[model samples]
Target: MPPETTGRAIFISYRRDDAEGEAGRLFDDLVRAFDEKSVFMDVAGIQPGSDFRKAIDQNVASCGVLLAIVGPHWASITDAQGNHRLENDNDFVRLEIASALTRNVPVIPVLVHEAKMPSADVLPENLKDFSYRNSVELTHARWNSDVALLVEALRSYVHVAKEHETEPIHATVPVQLPPPQPPQPDESASAKSRTPLFAGIAVAVLLAVGAGVFAATHHSQQPAQTAPSPVPAPAPVTPPAPESAALTPFIGRWQNTAQLTPKDSLLRLVVSNGGSQMLVHAYGKCEAGPCDWGTQPAIVDGSKAVTSAYQLRNNPQEVQLERSATLTLEPSADGLGVTITNSYQDAGTHPPGKALTYTFARATGS
Candidate 1:
């Protein structure tokens, strides 16, 4: 294979149902950071009537790295027939991964949406080796940092391939010359006698010719010199100022104006920028008085703003104690609203919890 075609690109392998959204987001970010032609996502690159397996194999072999996006249900998700998808030998995800591993390419398993690395026992024989590879997490809250690390890793391999492509070429040539002949002995005495006289005349003639040529050449080539200009001193260097807080669309006060709770219930959220961190203060009513769900820290990853779990101060005595709440900030379609999910449950629930979602409108003038 030519140096330009050998391990100079990236291939993305993902299950549609499991991580389609995450994979698309990653592809966009990668294209922005690197050459678009060097990044390949199957859905966008594959054509109609193409040999599917052959195309995947060729891409995997030519790519310097492969990113397998694994979502929460990636390993355990079932097909229409209620069978595990990975168990099938002909699964596209399995084939892509197996081909990459067989070719000794770098296969990075990108875990997203709380996905965990699968163990060897859960994988098919052809894909069992994938479990041992080191994985990176691309959470909604850490998308930028995670993708930056991935880009840096792939850059090294790309640099090596480019170096090979630019190597210098060398060539050689052969030349031949005739040998010299010896003088005759018969004319040696007379030749020697005339040598000194001829040499004196030859020397005088050569010197006169050389002097004339040198004087003419020097006169024609020399240019008139002018006075030298003064050199300017370099300006002093100034240190760069530190970056200020990033301005995000979510940086403002928002209030829950939705009507589904008690008449006295009121929810107010305040988001402020703090360099890389986003500070959030949420206040509301649980029954009649203030809901003491305290201040929280959030970070923006892509379009989503996520925060760590905070303990609710007003848990009912009959219910479980030590209950924690996680808040997720989702943007509304019109970009003028935000959906705040105040999830108190530890596990999955459709809609998460009763009266958990609060649609907040951006407070005017704040």
Candidate 2:
């Protein structure tokens, strides 16, 4: 309904059956921090008989960030697929979350009241650790602070969006990228000059070889000159060997598995079925060296694996080195692609606290 570039439009997803008032309040608060057009809500924007689901889908797809307002009954709702959908396949929440992810959009989950956060057992393996702790309280003052903090964070992301949309920052940031050097005439000239030197060396070698041959032939006749022994053959060279994988997972703070937590760091992984859940303990270490040996708890879900030691802290040392992956019996490139972030120290940081994220390929080996 409104012009898009409204600065990273915010999409709020909640169960209309549970806390409609809270969802509405959140939209109002977010609007105050952003523009009216930057916020999307069905009551405010969606028209009747205009394909509400499709409209929600499109808005969710277009939004730069999705805010999941998790209330007591949020996850209890059943979608058309009869699945408890929240940002996963067939789940509107999943659909919206996936779209944002695919478009590089961020999804922020805001828990209100007594709602239970989704754990590995209830959610797709990819989203298990994304659940926030008892991050939000229902109290008015805390709610206001949380909302304000979220707004501030959204604003920061919007600033990032604005900066990225404008002229590329890397282009103006005084990078060390060297300008392309023009072809030097001296290189070609040098090659040409070396040709004569090579010819001269060859001639000298030939003369020396001929002299030796003649001396050897005449030595028998003159008993004076002796031919020098032929030069020994040069030894063969060996190339450098590949690195070993002995010290992985412990190289530094690496995610023991796909759950987005640094290696060797302490994390609590809750795997649940129904209301019963089991806690899987793990540690994180910084991924470094070929072995990434510093990574720990080598055994995860009966799987023995290690994480890439690319991100020592926040530096992007390796592109193929996924910042994190989940510990599972069996792993795949896509099955475990969780990444860990270290922005949980700030009190007002939206989602307040943080947890290690792990990705899963299949359900589990066993």
Candidate 3:
């Protein structure tokens, strides 16, 4: 087995009883695009003696992206007892998808042989978001063209296995990421400098209050100065800039109850540009790491909600990168959480997917 990836890795998830053949073909294609060590499938990469569930969850979380190869029988297949395969907690495909969704792994449903995207009613609660994620279709006739679209989008996240490849190149050029840069010492000093300013403002407020109290006490003890000279009020201290309306209830780390699409489908809301501008930092599941959907520029409306746009390569090709999420804060017993309503518009033949809503709890440390 190859050593695991420290960077983002591509994870291919498919049911053996459903699209094993197609999954194998897809794996071969991906291996040529990324390093062989960067692509993973099945128990081939699991070490011996590891707990099955923990191992699978660890592998799923470690991956930056997951390809859910869905074939016609993918959903309807059953166990020997005739129960639906998806209903079983131990079902590998179900477990894989559930983990990916819960952990915010970008799961691009790869429809094989023109398999239709599964409907929400057909899916279990945790897997319902699978119905709405943008999907790519792979048929024997257009396999190369279709896969090239998939490869082009994946380039944004995973490392390219080589500089040359045997696959047909009918689409875009390879994505080249900049090399890592050394951390500058000045930035840390700049970060340090920021602390004193805030501390100074707080100190100023305290001093103002103390002076006001002392003046009143001293005035009471002294007789009124000859003839009243009208004294102007002390200058009003400008209150430190109020926190952005966009930061109140919405700022924090949050994850969806259903656990759909990566990087907010709301991860974290942070202040940027020295708090002059508020930025929402979210992640979509990706290889080598979670693909940063970027710090979404957020605007707050009168409703006390922040609005932002998010894009990802989860569903690439003609239909790649067009999913959207509507987030709102909901008051809970513990505190405020979030609800993410996801919608997708496929630029290809596929129509707009249904809007799926998910409740998100605040992340423990956020």
Candidate 4:
């Protein structure tokens, strides 16, 4: 309301090869807590053929905080040759982070997949400070709790920025009226000036007569003053309202978004708990029959699903954690079906597996 300063946006920096999946998941979570426009990631917003260096500088400059996503190989990732990628001067990750550090923005190191902070000796001269900053970790064992803490720390900056955006900008411009002409012989300006002067004298005489008449009448002593009342306790803070159902299009059931048979694949989406929580049940093809992967929770954020569910293998041979999977949906043009982005993290690997996508029509009754 007061020119919208003292607030800032969030800038996320991560390597596509290092922690792209985690970065995307973090973006969705932040979007739910703050405005979508305020939580920005280059993958979803950047257009082609533009000067990316300028874009990185602009975004970093406007941000109040920057999240540096560090994975196990974040420091050691290599390009086509054998050399480490971070050594390159023109690397986008290095450029954006350098900008934030130079501007004194709060740079938060986000560790994922059990990554440790890179020592100052391992980092470039300008980026060495990144190792000393306090960091937060997002672990598979407790993703929700860890992120909640991070969000709590970020509230001070985000709430102000959001309030600034929600304020209505005044659009009425003042009109400049011409000055009145000099009061010559019988100009209207002189008549207008005389009107208020005469009105003032009449108002003063009326007030004097009213006060004299009141003084003549009886006057009594004022009543005794009463003691002040005690103050009431402040009310408890209520949580903000949840996202509207109209904005969340994926609020119903649908058979395998991949459209595979029970023998090959079987999955269903049951959006319960007011559409904010989801139960995903699925089965994969195996020897003899389908492997029933039990149901698990996937937190829904608008059209996207920030899944914490693990796909378990329930086959004749054994039962164990197969892969951690995330299911995100985008409805089709005909409004009859949705496209799904099924991303997963493998059991043995720490890095997330490539996300697989599928499109299917909404399933009918049972």
Candidate 5:
């Protein structure tokens, strides 16, 4: 069997406030270079109400490559701790890039403005290598040429990565049948008769009885013979078989109300931007119910824009059933109201699934 193809979209990591316009253009170019579905552009791609951090992490993890859109202010931003931090080194970006790298996803550094390329001394220990790597410089005078080169490089990288992703599977050859031996002529007359000696005597006796009965009536009688039975052939052999999503930008601490019921309880879901994958942690309870911890898988599915699906973890039958729900996150047109559709499914014999949709305004101060 051939290796499975790793064809995927690219994740764009950049500081939105610092380079939305340029980043948006760069994203557009990338989409033109490859299947737009496989690329992630933060400027216009993220939806409102959905968990932006979670969405970004999931996108990066699932993508085939990570493109760092470094602008002049990329290294000037401060984390919550007020320390100047490179976007690539930011918690969310780090997680996304690290997850991709963990899976051998290619990473490309594209310089969007006049940001001084960090040297080994100034660069974070983890990003020192990227500092020395060649980058595409997009200045006003050479914007077109720089973009063309970046797109070309991205196209080539994706093409090669896709090739390596697919490996072929080989089928086993069938064994041939041995040649048949020639049939020998029967030496004994008894053997040539094709009937056992006892069976021949029995047939003779029956024929004699029939002759006695039919001769008396002047009817002719003859000995009876048996014909051979045919055997069926074998059948042919067969071979073996082998075997998200984007969400809108909802930046906030949202509660998982889908998990609540008349049984009495509430669950709090914190969808924050962790390094590579979304840091999804759940804590809360129905009236007096116990709380359990777990993680769920996410996917991207949408037409007008990319959508993300985050499946919640749920387990019942035990003393404490884990609360869970699926959130469909998508970005809004104005890039302010992200849509988050949360759904819930029941457990045991009778299960009732419920879905709740809402548009969340981006949290102030995010």
Candidate 6:
């Protein structure tokens, strides 16, 4: 690492299969609290290169603090071979933790999703020490307090390190010398005597100059010559024309209860125009089940709007499916009604499955 990148940094180690969402949220919060460059999340910071292990080790060593994010399934998660990942010596998470421990770096175990600290018996030999370190819990209910504690700890460490770095190895005490002695009495007396003589000469010269200046001013004075031309008032400034109204046909909150699953699910849509383009944020209400809600940027062409494709993860099957939505708007007596059509495609499939449509009525307030 270069000297510029040597200062305090936080390294977040997490498993995608475990608590990627929590880890990502924490990273974003840390970035805001500290700085974007100071918080390094593995996947976002990693660069393409050979010797991936070397990269991980270097980052771990250089960081001021390492945050090991432990989700519910972190330890027991299995690899493709179906063996426990923590049991494998070559596992990336294991390597990262082990390296940080070996280098005596401060390691903080962050427990998310109400996860408990792993017992010593469950950890591999190299990672057994991790069980003893103090752990912090991050719950959705107390996210602010938990993250504040973590930030305070990291900031304290960085401050101490900086103070230590700036302290002088060997300080020198500045020497003091006595003030100079007073000048001789004869020299002082002569200087004082000459000061008054110079002052008298200056006073006489000023009086003569003042008399001449008074005479010149008295002769040159002229009375109010022809009432000074009346100053014209400034022209009244015209205010700039009001900006053309924004294209905001679909810019408000809309909600609807699906007939197929009435009372169980509610669909909500929020739309706003972004000058050159449009933005749509959709959320599927889940009163009785899991729901996925996300924002997608869309392009607007007249009444038609299409969003970019984004992936939706199916946790149970461990599969990622691509989905995109198109919305068409039509003016109605009550308000503008939107027709949302969503298209889904599985991996390796060309054509998408049958599209689904949902209707939404504009809400009262923006």
- Tell me each candidate's TM-score: 0.44, 0.39, 0.47, 0.43, 0.36, 0.42
Q: Write the per-residue lDDT of candidate 6 for residues 1-366, one digit (tens) a residue.
A: 434334437889899999999999898777666666676786456665636587778888888778899999999999889999998877888988998888878677889998977877899999986875556678998686556545544553353323232211122467687998997679778888997989999999999999999987787556646877889999999977422233365667776645646323226666655334455655454443423333445665565566654233212121233444455654445565556554556535644544455566777666
Worst 10-residue lDDT window, candidate 3: 265-274
Please give the RMSD of candidate 6 to the true structure: 17.7
lDDT, residue 132, model 5 = 34
For candidate 4, write residues 1-366 as lDDT tens digits: 112211238888899998999998888778776767667685345556657777677777777788899999999988898877779887888887888888877677889999987877788877876665556689878776566556654643455454433321223578788999985676777777897989999999999999999977956577768889989889999977666563346545555545465434434544332333444443344453433343345565555665444443333112222334445556666332323333334444444545555554456752
Q: Which is better, 1 or 6, measured by lDDT?
A: 1
Instruction: Estimate every model's Cα lDDT from 0 to 1.
Output: 0.67, 0.48, 0.66, 0.62, 0.50, 0.65
Question: For model 5, how does the per-residue alpha-carbon lDDT over 1-366 read when each residue is reduced to its tens digit?
Answer: 111212346777777766777777776666555655656664245555656556655566566667777777765677678876554443655555555555555565566667655555655656554543334457767665455544433442355335333211223477698999998776787466766767889999999999898868984466555676777777777753211122324334454434356443324443443222233333335332433232222333342222233332222222133233444545465333223333334457434345444443333343
Sorting all predicted structures by TM-score, with the top scorer first, yields 3, 1, 4, 6, 2, 5
Pairs in steric clash, model 4: none
Model 5, residue 272: distance off in Å is 43
Give the candidates in order of lDDT, highest first.
Answer: 1, 3, 6, 4, 5, 2
Could you tell which candidate, 3 or 6, scores higher by lDDT?
3
lDDT per residue as tens, model 3, 30-86 = 877666766788655677876667767778888888888999988999999999999
Q: Pick by TM-score: which candidate is best?
A: 3
Candidate 6: which pairs clash?
Answer: none
Q: Candidate 5, which segments miss by more than 4 Å at Cα?
A: 1-8, 43-54, 79-81, 86-90, 159-366
How big is the positional error of residue 24 in model 6, measured in Å on the Cα after superposition? Answer: 0.4
Per-residue accuracy of model 1 over 1-366 as CA lDDT, tens digit each: 223333438889999999999999888777666756667786457666767787778878888778899998888988899999998877889888999989888677889999987867899998886875556678878676566545544553354434233211122345566876877566778777897989899999999999999987778655868879989999999976423333366777787877646533337777765434565666656663444344556766666787766555342320233345566776665443444444434444322444355677888887
- Per-model clash counts, in order, read 0, 45, 13, 0, 41, 0
